[model samples]
Target chain A: MRDIHTSAITDAVKKLCMEANWNLEPDMLRAFDRALGRERSAAGKQVLQTLKDNAELARTKRIPYCQDTGMVVCFVELGQDVHVTGGGLYDAINAGVSEGYKEGYLRASIVRSPFDRVNTGDNTPAVIHVDVGPGAEMKIMVMAKGGGCENRSKYKMHTPADAAGAKDFIVECVKTAGPDACPPLVLGVGIGGTFEKSAILSKKALFREIGSPNPDPALDAMEKELLEQANRLGIGPQGYGGDTTAFAIHILTYPCHITSLPVAVTIECHAHRHKEATL
Target chain B: MSVTTANDGIKDLSTPLSDQDVASLKAGDRVRITGVIYTARDAAHGRLAPLIEKGEKLPIDVRGQIIYYTGPSPARPGDVIGAVGPTTASRMDRFTPALLRLGLKGTIGKGYRGDAVKAALREHQAIYFGAIGGAGAVLSRFVKKAEVVAYEDLGTEAIRRLEVENFPAIVLYDCHGGDLYQEGQKVYAREGA
Candidate 1:
């Protein structure tokens, strides 16, 4: 078995946290450029332009993209043939989050409890998900999820007969979210799993690059159709109104029990900040 | 749908806005606000609301003042404020009308304000402005000075008084009941339909 040092994971997580917070991924930047061209409203176009400029300034100046630096969510794919050494994997990850948020000058947005609400100070205890995969390599994907968009995410367990209702459900969610979740959003729709699984799947789908087609042909078509319908809502950039309400809609599906047709929609703002590293 | 740029030419507005100033502004007008504005988010508002109900003096005066719903990152060395941007305004809706009754003239935030908050805006001759969500770094450039005025233990949620210059915002709700978010969406939805 190949041994991977947990310290390396901590260091990598720290750097990834800083990098993801400061820079808008290239795919997101390109999406904004394309949206700017397609947007019809002058005000919407202006908002898009400012978003582009903000991304540039954040990268060059090394400033966190938004004041809500976001709660760190990490997904880890650990190879079955690899053994972690030096320390516990979860502790290392949380340590990295603390170090990164403090050193990078990113906001520490985490609170100790949902109700009692006290700042964790260093953005610790990352929401981590781990899955076992083949080979001897480890893959780490990190997303800085802002509260505005996160608060707007939705999940529903529709009756099996309601399978076709995903489109309406998602559209309704976006319509209800309106300008609040930050329009020109990237929507991640997860289908066919259990309630919680669907929610996780939806969030995982967000890591996919904007405009990339889903591997399953059927799901890919649904993504396209949903994107078109969502944009037709005219929520536009910052919800001011125009043709580009959603930049992309990504759908992921898995087989589920015959009785269940669960779907979850995770809305991500234009700042779709995520970074991945393989070791 | 007719697009009226009612307050378009009035780009820079200072705090302690006059009645005429608030009356003249309409939803969808783009403006760069200047001078002093107070910052308060969930925690600060929670504390301030109780005191307001008790008829006690608030840490900051409410008369003719604008409260920005924000919890900014700590400013780095050599910067006046860290990335400071508006938070979701809906979260503040519960405590808003009380402050409005106390003569709070304006608010800066993102997202839709609930019906009651909009009603309070109309009744009190106040306004709501939307700053570009997620443009915190760029917005910080406009904050010329910032100091934590109260609730120091609240960290980012502390009440801060900021001196700003050319800080941009779009009027989302006006004292006359013009709602930019609803109006803007209707204009496009109809065209698309």
Candidate 2:
């Protein structure tokens, strides 16, 4: 088995965290450019322009794009044939988060516990999702998920026959989210899995590029349709009202039990910060 | 980047907003705010609400001042403030009316306010302003100075009194009960419908 040093993972996570906060991904930038041209509301266009200017300034100034540096979420795909050396995988990941937030001058947004509510100081204890994959390389995908949009994400368990209701539910979710989730959102939809699985799938769907199509033609069609319907609500950019409410909708589906049909919607603001690295 | 100058009929407002200032504002009017403002988010507001209930003097004066619902990032070596943007305003809805009743004239935040908060604004002749939600880096440039005024232990959630110049914002909810979120949706959705 090939051995991967945990320090390498730590270093990668640290750099990725800082990089993700400072720069909006290229795909997101392109999506914003497209939205600027397509937006109908004058205020909406101005909002989009401000966002573009913010991204540019953040990159040049080496500052965070938003004040909420976000809770770090890392998706680690570990190879079955590879072994992690130096320490436990999670410990290394947490160490990376601590260094990243501290050195990068990012905000420490995490609390020790949800109920007790004290700052963790270093933004540690990243939410890590691990999948064992074939091959020898380990891939880590990091996302800085802001709390505003995360608060708006929803999960619902629907009956098997309520397939048509899923679309309506997504539209309603965006409607209710309105300006709170930061309009011109990117929606990640997870369908056909169990409760927790569906939630995870929805988050994973967000890792895809903004304009990329799903591998499954049916899922891609659903994404396109949902996106069109969401923009029709006229929530617009920053909810000032316009035709370009949502930039993109992504769907990831999985097989599930006969009695359960779970759907989860994970909404992301325009500051969609994510980066990936393989080792 | 320099602060965005007020243009296109956008008015310039200063702190210690008067009733006339609140009255002149409308739901959709863009404005550049200058002068002293306070910052408080969920935790600081939680503490302030209880203090107000117990009839204790607050650490910072709320008289006719605007409170920005933001938790800014740590400033770099030479910067006055780090990227600062408005957080979701609805999270602070429950504690808003108490502050409004105490002569808090305005709030700067993102997203929709609840009906209770809107009613309180109308009752108290207050207003709510919306900053560009995710445009923190751009917005932070307008903050000329920032100093922690209270709740230092709360870290980023601590209340900061900021001196700002030409900070851009739009009137989301005016004292007259004009709601920008509702009005904007009505105007744009009609065409689509």
TM-score of each: 0.97, 0.98
Candidate maximizing lDDT:
2
- Tens-digit lDDT track for model 2 on A197-220? 999988899999889888889888
lDDT of 1 by residue, A1-279 (tens): 999898899999999999998999999999999988778898899999999989998899888889998989999999999899998999989988999999998898999999999998999879999999899999999999999999999988888888668678988788887888888798888888688888888989999988788888988887787778888887788988888888888888888999999999998998789999988
Q: Candidate 2: where are CA atoms >4 Å away?
A: B1-7, B190-193
Runs of candidate 1 with Cα error greater than 4 angstroms are B1-10, B190-193
Interface RMSD values for the candidates, listed in order? 1.8, 1.7
Question: Which 10 successive residues of model 1 chain B have the least lDDT summed?
Answer: B1-10
Tell me the tens digit of each residue's lDDT in model 2 across B1-193. 2123355688888888887788888999999999999999999999998899999999988988999999999999999999999999999999999999989999999998889999999999999999998899999999999999999999899999999998999999999989998888776773322
Among residues 3 or more apart in sequence or in different chains, the pairs in candidate 1 whose N, CA or C atoms overlap within 3 Å are none
Q: What is the overall TM-score of model 1 with all chains considered together?
A: 0.97
